[model samples]
Target: MLVNMKKILEIAEAEGYAIPCINTPNEETVRAVIGAAEELNTPIIIDHAQVHDSLIPIERIGPIMLKYAKEARVPVCVHLDHGSDYEFVMRAVKVGFPSIMYDCSALPFEENVEKVAQFVKFAHAAGITVEAELGIMASTDEDTHDDDPEKRVLTNEDIREFFTEPAEAKEFAERTKCDALAVCFGTMHGIYAEPPVLDIDRVKELREAIPDDTRIVMHGASGVEFDQVQNAITAGCSKVNYYSYMAKATTKFVADKVAETDGKIAYHELQEAAYEFMKGYAKDVIKAFKNGK
Candidate 1:
């Protein structure tokens, strides 16, 4: 079913595990994620980012993502991830991305919130859900990886100003009326050691501070202590974003498959394996969110 991001998050919260929001670099990758989601019999997220070449031309990926959501037997949400570009964001709304992440975390506090408020208006009017970011999370710029992930931390002092404080998050929600909030608390965009010691208690507190039904999103969410799948769900992270890992994992899977088959791997066979691997990953992740876990 083609549900909104809010519906998916509700499913996650009620089910006790965050839904896997996989990033697909291309058509094959898209198929791999959705295929896995369907095979696992769980709802999933298709995340799109303009800055990532793997996700250029939202015009191309948007419609295709929507199509897959419609075709899939399980629930799915098409999300525009971390795009600060106004024109591109508007375009995505027109093209119909059910959810959007306006990454103004890099901007000044007031400016970021102002811009988010403005866009929230635009998105809500269109019946599209908006996800606004706060507190910059650090990651390898690919240009700057001196090996210390600590170098990328958004100032702890600045974290409060950059994003809505837990008390203020509710007001921001009421004023901007955003459907979801992506708050930062020591997560990095790329691989980092030990998952940066998550303030899971803070997350729990924030969860209580927000509107009971409002969705909570966590970005830069890969590379953690426990499985990324399990930890987020337990922390009450409703919508978890996974990008770098999914694309890289897909590439690695293909490369290894080709090597193992001695270049004799057929196209369908490779995709089939990729799909199966992802499905198992999704199933394992969903299990973490299950009540017994």
Candidate 2:
């Protein structure tokens, strides 16, 4: 069933589990995530990032996602993830995404909060839930491996000054009135070069400081282990965003299948194999995120 993102996250928060938020750019991935969620009987988030807009334009993809959500037995929320472009985010809201994540964390603190506040007002008026990030997350992806300093691991001083402070997070939430808040405690985008050291303690603090009903989102969670993810959920992460793992799973499946076929496999069969692999990956991830619920 199609459901509000805030309601789904609230349920996860109450149940002490994190809902898997998958960035899906096509129908295959969309079906994979939703199908796994239905089998698991857990709520799921289907997210579309701004960078992927060209590949799966909102005009075409939005209704397809809404249709999938409506057909699914389990709850599904169509969400726009990391929507840095104001016009594009508004377009997503207009296209009927239940949730929209406005990523303005790169801006000055006050400016970020102010801009989010403005968008939150507009989104809420349209009966759409809003998500905003406070701390800047580091990236290690192909597009930003070398140039972006924010992509590096969070230093001790960075944690204190750059990442979301519990007190400041409370203020930001209260002021922005966002339904969800994405925090950068100690995770980066893309595959990790070293083991990630998450600030589970800070997650606990943020949970205590923020409203109990407000959803706490953790981005850059793709490569983290299940145990660490469990700890984050225990601490208060209700929504965990993952992209790299799913992409990797699909890509690897197709590459291996093609090699095995010696270029003789039918294109449709290869696509089916990739889709099935993605579904399998989604099932495992959903189980891990929900602690085998």
Candidate 3:
């Protein structure tokens, strides 16, 4: 069934698990992610990143995502990931996204709170679930990061500077009334320069401090070890955004399959194989975040 993020995340929080929110920028990914959720009989969130707009505009993919969500055996939430621009976020709302991440973390704390608070009012009135970011999430993905080499190689200590303060998280959640708040602890997006170490204690602190209605969220979970990821879920994160590593793994899988087949596989066959691979990959992610629930 198609549902808003708040509905699923509420259950996740109560049940001691985190829902895996994956980026599905194309039809194959949409099918694979939903397929995985159905197979596991678990709720899943499939998001279209604003950054992937050039690859496939929300206008073109929004309905497709909603259609699949409505038809899926398990609940699925179609969300807008990192919708930094007001206009772009409105576009997702117009396209009928049930959930959206209105990221204003780059702005000053007061400005970020003001912007999200205003949007939350409008969003809640329309039954849309709003997600806001409290801290700037670091990125190692070349596409999302600066070209400066120094910026990409972040140590554990470097990431600590971006960690969300529990008291600040409480204030942000209370003021904005967001359904979910993404906070930085230790993970960075894309392939990790070094294995990411999650601040599990921070997650617990944030959970305790933030409003009960506002679920804690962890972004850049892709490269982190599954054990650490699950620990975070147990500590408090109810929504985990993962994708970078999964996408890269899929690419390598397709390449290896082509080589194994000596390039004799038909193009459609290759696509189908890739889709199958991703379905299984997504299942593993869902199970891991479930934290044995």
Top-TM-score candidate index: 3
Model 1, range 1-293, lDDT digits (tens) per residue? 78778788787777777776777656666776777777668888887876763436888778888888889899988888887888878778888887888877778767876888888887777777788876666655453456765565544343333333677666666666677888766566765544355667667777888786677777766555445435555867787776666556667988999999899989988887887776566555444445343
Model 3 RMSD in Å is: 0.9
Clashes within 3 Å, all models in order: 0, 3, 0
Query: On a 0 to 1 TM-score scale, where does candidate 1 land against the true structure?
Result: 0.84
Query: Each candidate's TM vs. the true structure?
Result: 0.84, 0.93, 0.98
Best by lDDT: 3
- What is the lDDT for 11 in model 2? 82
Query: Where does candidate 3 stray beyond 4 Å?
Result: none
The per-residue C-alpha lDDT of model 1 at residue 240 equals: 75
Which pairs of residues have clashing backbones in candidate 3? none
The CA root-mean-square deviation of candidate 2, after full C-alpha superposition on the true structure, stands at 2.2
> Which pairs of residues have clashing backbones in candidate 2?
138-150, 138-151, 139-151
State residue 234's C-alpha deviation in candidate 3, in Å: 0.5
